[model samples]
Target chain A: MTAQALHQHQPHRPEDGHKLHGYPPGDLAIWVFILAELGAFFVLFTVYAFTRLKHLQLFAEMQRTLDSDAGMINTLLLITGSWCVARAVAAIKRNHCRASAHWLLAAIGSGVGFLIVKYFEYGAKFAAGINLDTNLFYTFYIALTAFHAMHVVLGMAILLLVWKKAMAGGYSAQDHHGMETGASYWHMVDLVWIILFPLVYVMR
Target chain B: MGVHFLNVIWVALMVATVLTWLIGKTGELSTAMVVAVLVISAVKGWLIIYDFMALRRVRLLWRGLVLGWLLLTLSIILLAYWLGIK
Candidate 1:
């Protein structure tokens, strides 16, 4: 309803509204979607947390089998990515388009690096003769993290577009809509990793 | 015995307690300590949504979307409890 109202008014109205110099309304809409995705991921995280509390002993045993070092390293990688993307947003705000592009590239690079590490982690689990059907804990781990990897892929795609736009000087301090929305999505991805780290890696 | 090092959350909390003790000897069970940590985590989340996303001061409706996440969390826990029941 709100979208239809905005759409009906947008064509008739000139492009002279309170849009930031370069931020696009379409991008802001995407950010709202990212927030919704975060909502879903948090629901998953919350369920896992509560379930783990019930099966504390089993979870503790499961934790002992899992690769904490890989989890920790991935956590660090994501934290680094979060910082870089936050910098990218700040650079966009300052109209430093080139710097924003650089940060976005680094953030995208981290997404790739995360997947590389994740591949190895999954390989290790497979080599241990484990599969998603191994147990409830393993099932949740694979399902949630696989879903998370999809978000990483999505985030990388968004960052790539933002980087291209940045390089073209397409986003002005006022019009950098994609930057804000992309940052929101990346932050959601990082937030999920944060919860997963402590729950799946740290807790016993 | 060495499993103490395996559960990283325990180690982290233990480190936090020791560090807090060094700073002020505010040992564990101090409401100040537990509340302090929880408050920090919540604020960290707020910063992720508000600053990183630049939604620092969005309108009430937009803000409500973020708040809705907490409600979702509660519902998820309830659902999990039902599922866990046998």
Candidate 2:
């Protein structure tokens, strides 16, 4: 896990052509992946909205049962985490590896807070005998949020790996594509939740 | 991007989220309010794309593709809601 070892592990790929064309910070492949992921969520959200349109009363009632307070808190946590990720990228770009790692750790901490809040939120619902099969709204609610929770877990795993490499000094100002990739994915998770929070928890 | 710049974007996003919540609490499902919420969400999404994702430095094609997706999806959803609202 030494810096040299980590650096040597990533073989150079000159043909990658990532930043050659004025593109975003991350690997081009990842941007494509993010687009596909967002596309999937877009379909799911559309389905939820149109379905709710048909059963407006049921949707509104089930929405009231949700804890908007918890949703709002989770929204804050994810946004803060995303900000930390941005800072981490900025720090590494300045060749401040240790600072980058610190910022990433903070970002991971925010992710942990989000998961804990979500746990309690889901726990409360289950305790009240609510399940996906409870009704249409509950079904979409659990499905969309649970799917999103899985994405958050995946994003956290990516961040953890990035943090470990960062601590080993794997990333520097010129070569932090891995960190950028992980940060991009984390932001995608946050983005989805931003839209999801209002549509599911707040909108009537 | 500067740390200060990213922080500003983050703050803007937080403010947008609070406004979205407050507007949703206005106790009505009028088309105007729904469109407003959707517009705010689009703005928040763009801020993240441009700043946090560093899309601003990217070429116009890549930037346009992502931004196009956001607007297209939001427009479709807004249209659906508008149609179903009445």
Candidate 3:
């Protein structure tokens, strides 16, 4: 579709003087979903924080056993992935489909890197016979990180689909809503990890 | 946003991540250290929400919702930390 045709389809608000202004980019449904997801995580994080207050010593000691280096690496990976996904959206907005696809692939690569690092980290814990029942700390640690890792998996899958579509010239500067939606989800995954790393591994 | 601008943001995020890691490595358990780490995290989260997520240019409601989420979550965690310290 031409840019003119795209603009016609979009609802014109008085505040939306420009195409990209007044409303959040991408589908409105995705933003609703993102807010719900963030709400869920907020509850989980709050629970973990207050619970730690009750058993500070156990939480701190267990935190020490965690590999902070691995956590740091994963944080970097997710941040890099977010950057690539952001670039992908930017490229698509400019009608650079090929570059957008390449950026999506790069984001997926970073996600894969994160999962691999997490796998080893989990492997070490399992080898040491750690399980959900180990203690309150390990339970929260395992549950929280595992939950976040699952989101990473889902985010990468979304990116892969976006990448496939981009490679097929399915997106253009005139309309790339799907690409923006996927990028938004990927960045939320990264944002969550930004807090998780410090709360679980670094913060005393 | 321009590609160059995105690159600059990426570089800033990287440097901040490294600083947080170094603080973790120091292993000095104090209230101040915790506050420092959480503050750094809030900044990182802000950049991701506004820049990478492209919410900076959107309506205030959207931007405020996400940023509000970040602030409230961090504040609750900080309160819990303070209680623990007490």
Choose the strongest candidate by DockQ. 3
Candidate 2 local lDDT, A29-139, one digit each (tens): 677788899999999988998898899889887888888888888988998999999999889888899999999999999999999999999999999999989999999
Model 3: interface root-mean-square deviation in Å: 2.6
- In candidate 1, position A62 carries an lDDT of 78
True-structure lDDT of candidate 3 = 0.88
What is the CA-based DockQ of model 3? 0.67
Residues A132-181 of candidate 1 have per-residue lDDT tens digits of 99988998889988999998999889889888989999876666655766
lDDT (10s digit) by residue, model 1, range B23-81:
22222223344334333334444555544444444554655566556345534544443
Better of 1 and 2 by TM-score: 2
Candidate 2: regions farther than 4 A off? A1-21
Off by over 4 Å in 3: A1-20
Better of 2 and 3 by lDDT: 3
Q: What is the C-alpha lDDT of each candidate?
A: 0.62, 0.84, 0.88
DockQ for each model: 0.14, 0.54, 0.67
- Arrange candidates, best lDDT first: 3, 2, 1
Best by lDDT: 3
Q: Model 2: DockQ against the native?
A: 0.54
lDDT (Cα, 0-100) at A15 in candidate 3: 38
